[model samples]
Target: MQLPGTTLLVIDDDAAIRERVANSLEESGFNVLQAGLAADGLALLGRQRPDLVLCDLQIADMSGFELLRQITELDPDMPVIVSSAAGSMGDVVEALRLGASDYLIKPADAPVIEHAVRRSLDRASLRLENQRIRERLERVNRELELHLKELKDDQAAGRQVQLNMLPASPWNSGEYRLEHRIIPSLYLSGDFVDYFRVSDTQLGFYLADVSGHGASSAFVTVLLKFMTTRLMYEQRKQDVAGPVAFKPSDVLGHINRSLIACKLGKHVTMLGGVIDEAAQTLTYSIGGHLPLPVLFAEGEARYLQGKGRPVGLFDDASYEDHTIDLPPRFSLTLCSDGVLDCLEGTTLREKEQRLPTRVAEAGGEMRRFMERLGLDPSRPMPDDISVLVLSRNPA
Candidate 1:
């Protein structure tokens, strides 16, 4: 919007040239200010902040070069057009170096002079707009960085809380030992384990790997712990003669129903068990758990036999319970499938061969087994890796 009050100050000592330029500018809707001397022009500039200026190179009192310099110091962004004659080429170039935005020929046409003024003002407006956009982009980038840092900090705090909820490792009592170690690929793990006494002579333990990873899968692990802990508590309150309540199959069925009810769209592969030290028996169930549980004793190790569909998949899915008479002294090792990916094997059979042999060599110690596999807890893993070991130390 070019308003009538838009001002242009013309400083040309020639009476005729100054009046002609001022008349052309006034016709173009600009308020015109005429000055025949540099001092008068400088005074007008201080009195009025014109949008542009037209200066003749040979103005009197002060040189046009001096006036250009003073104009730049007053307002560097203001556009300036210098009018010069043929012999003043050198002075015109020097004026440009002194900050004139454009140049006009001495006998300048009205149209051309008006065009130069408008073009210079447009360039100045574009520069200001570009600077504003760059500053705005920088501010947005800084805000995004701050938001990302907050999310990372929250995840770290959540990871620590999950770790604190896990049962302590290398736990020992009477003739039984139970312990576990887990390394998560992310801040939180989908793998979980628990071991606790279910009766005077019965010890219960289980290892589970929830589907998926991170927060959603970790939520299922918490559910697994809660359901199992509650089942054990309720069972202990009932008659001991009643069919052992936490039998492997019953535990799997209960978990299957609860997870399906929760509608989390997630499933779990697990090995749940009850060890009867008095009867020398280990009754267990498997819900699609892999690499099966391996039993190592004396000088040998082999995978336990058990089978069933993964829990939380189907409402009618049933588990077949299996029982083995445990030797007087044995080490049972449970591993999540993530560990198999770390083995340097071309076939599943070869990786399976590595697991038991390594267990027998470690003599049921979690540390020794992990060391043999070159596992580092501090380093990030491709997937979550977990190990649960139940052993009876040699007397």
Candidate 2:
């Protein structure tokens, strides 16, 4: 079948052969351009840039082999068929060697000429289509690379923001020392920890594990910070005279309400506490978190008692306050559930059972305890891992 708007050039020294070939191609829906001299054909090829060329082996101005070579040089993909009355094997081989697409005899029938022209045009069309498709794929790949770079840049900035919001590790106040480490599966973490002075006599701290992972969960950690910080500010503003008196349960409840009101569709499992230096006591609360905080004192370790619903899930989810007297020389370790994955156990129950024993092995030193748990930040993890240790009078 003829390609739409197809143009063909015919070159031959014999007027009868050239006109006959041109008439046959024009009848088969091609726009035909005839040239009796090789020079005219080359000039017309450069100007019109026809889809296919029909050239005679011998022409007045130049040999058909020379014209074929020049035509291929102009456009290597251009299709050209050579016609010759000599019909010798030598002439046929020479025409093909010079980049001719097909060979035809001088007295060829109309059907034979049309079939060759259509086949050559079809092959050229396919080559052009493949080139277009290859270019499109390359362009798409370049765009995807640019978008990936932009996403990585955004994650890096978000990670820095999270790092800046964290409390300083190995922070010391009076006889108490606080330290923490977080390992994120991605560039940003869904797990978060914070500790700050609520007043001269009280210190506040919490470790929260937001639902899911990546950017969305990391965003909730920022919200948790803002909610808790704002809650403390409001409570302190109410009374500027004495030490700030607020319960850990109160903080958790405030966060629950704030998160639910914002309709974020996310929740948090957390453990928070306030340490009273004067009273030598730690009042704490839990919000659907596990495997509970472990307290190591005097070569022994035990889990603290607290149970509550996860924050931000329900409107009526209430928190309970639990209090314990502080030991003179002790460390309390708190971790997100991601730590449980690294623990030595096949079951959750088995892991929880072994945690207290692990704490006892570390002997109340924060760094040693982290080593025992294999909490290395540089190693890759499937989920976010966070550990917070609060110690008073190190052993």
Candidate 3:
């Protein structure tokens, strides 16, 4: 069907042929322009920018092929149909190579002319639509790239904050030395650890693993730090009696209630301890942690025994404190369950059985223990891993 207001320019040296083509197109709902010379046709094209062009292969002022080339340079997508009285097969192919939309024999009927014009217009419209779709996709891709960059920047900032909250590593108080390492599966970690002087005679430390990983889990680590710090301050202030008021079980209980009150829908597995340097005793508590703490002494390593419900998950959750006489030359290692992945075992029972052996192989030193387990902190891990080693004297 001929489109309404579709303008077609007809260029032919013969005035009779030019008028006949123009009149036929106009009768079929097209607005037609007629030019008997090539120069006139090019001028009309520059001014009118018609939707399609019909040109004779031979014209008085210029070659039809040359006019087609110039039109293509001006608007490469313009559709041009070339008609000739005696066009050879070579001529038809040449016209097509010059970007003609169609080649016509001089005796073609009006219906044939109309069909060629409609087909070329439809193809041009389809091309225009495809170009529009491609432009939209490019725009969308640029926007997505920008959003991903912003997200990465935010995560980097969050990671720095978590790093700052950590206590100094390889810390020394009295004859005891404390060291810790945390490896996160992503830019942020859900595992945390800390050691600080509780009093002139006491040193306290703990390792906590929050459920889940990444940003949300990392946020919970911040809360854990705040709760522990504030609890230590409050206990020291109120007790006036002794640092014994700062017990590991009490600390865990306080954190459990606080997390439940905040309704953050998260939980933690932790192990905490208080060391009395003057009396040479270690009092510790556990909160649903796994693989238990390993105590290395006299060149032997073994897991300590303890069990409790995970914090923040149960209102009635309680922790128990267990006391042990400190061996003069000893190392106590606390690890988050993520270390289980690095352990060689087919089952939980097998992995637990192997942990103490691995600790003994590393001699309870944090660096050697990591190497013995083939754990590379720089590489990606499936979960967050944390290690806290408290040692006093060496063999």
Q: What is the lDDT of candidate 2?
A: 0.91
Off by over 4 Å in 1: 1-133, 240-244, 347-349
C-alpha positional error of residue 327 in candidate 1 after TM-score superposition, expressed in Å: 1.5
lDDT of each: 0.87, 0.91, 0.91
Q: Write the per-residue lDDT of candidate 2 for residues 190-253, one digit (tens) a residue.
A: 9999999999899999999999999999999999999889999998999696678779999999
Put down candidate 3 lDDT per residue, 1-395, tens digits, no spaces.
46587898998989888888888888888999989988888899999999989999898889878988888887898989999988899889989999998999997899999899888888888888898999999899899899889878988999999999998898887788999999999889999999999988899999999999999999999999999999999888887765547899999999999999999999999999999988899999999999699999999999888899999999999899999999999999999999999988899898988999999999999999999988888998999999999999833
Residue 244 accuracy (lDDT) in model 3: 48
Tell me how many clashing residue pairs each candidate has.
0, 0, 0
Q: Which of candidates 1 and 2 is the stronger one according to TM-score?
A: 2
**1 or 3, which is superior by lDDT?**
3
Give the Cα-based TM-score of candidate 2 against the true structure.
0.89
CA shift of 161, model 2, Å: 1.3
Span of 10 residues, lowest total lDDT, candidate 2: 238-247
Which candidate order results from sorting by TM-score in descending order? 2, 3, 1
Please report the candidate that would top TM-score against the real structure: 2
Candidate 3, residue 79: lDDT: 89
Q: What lDDT tens digits, residue by residue, belong to model 1 across residues 294-392?
A: 999878988998789999998999998899998878899999998898776999888988888888888878889998788899989999999999998
